[model samples]
Target: MSTAHTALIVPPRLGEPLRVVPVEGPDSLKDLLGGDFESVARGDWHLYLNAEGTTGDLPANLRAAQLMHDCGLDLAGAARGPAVILGRDAKGKDTNIPEHLLRRAEELFGTPQAA
Candidate 1:
């Protein structure tokens, strides 16, 4: 069975002053995504961050598609935005894709991890 953990892939064009926050479950994301989780899931389906302090092999994508396709932003313009942000437990405070579970997600999504 594939465990269903959520992730947030911010657009590559978002501006600075972006802060990582503890989001709830799919509902929170759905709310932010205007109730279209499928778009977020299928819109390139890329996670660009490399989980820290890990020895396991990571993905080696020379290029990845847009991180956001449903955020209603001109992706081409947000080139300087943060690359990616995965989900984690976040100490049970909010939704998160823990670094430990990152490899699993990588395998599931087939997205190359960041160097």
Candidate 2:
């Protein structure tokens, strides 16, 4: 089983500041993605687990795709404006993805964790 750790840095624009939150597995990802989950293909799926902590095994690429699907759904209702940051930490180093759907989450649902 493989595990990965990813962080979604939601920028403040719609109504909140910047927030850095980590997503461990599928369950934790669900909280950030909500419904509308699907399977990831190639670019749509990836992993970044933390070697220091344990969170079961990392979900499959398909699972990551599902999470991305959910993210898309969340973005549909998000306001258009500032860009949100979705960092994929593979070696614990932050790697930014150009086109991120999670940004919509911040625009639609104000940053609850930011507070």
Which candidate ranks first by lDDT, i.e. highest? Answer: 2
Each prediction's Cα lDDT score?
A: 0.35, 0.37
Please estimate how well model 1 matches the true structure, expressed as its whole-model Cα lDDT.
Answer: 0.35
Mind giving the per-residue lDDT tens digits that candidate 1 earns over 35-100?
333221222233333222022233222212332332233334323322344442324323344443
> Number of clashing pairs, model 2?
11
* Candidate 2 lDDT by residue in tens digits, 2-63: 34444543322334444555545556544444322332223343322222111323222232
Candidate 2 positional error at 33, Å: 2.1
Displacement of residue 30 (Cα, Å) in model 2 is: 1.0
Clashing pairs in 1: 12-78, 13-78, 87-96, 87-97, 88-96, 88-97, 88-98
- Assess the local accuracy of residue 33 in candidate 2 as a C-alpha lDDT between 0 and 100: 40
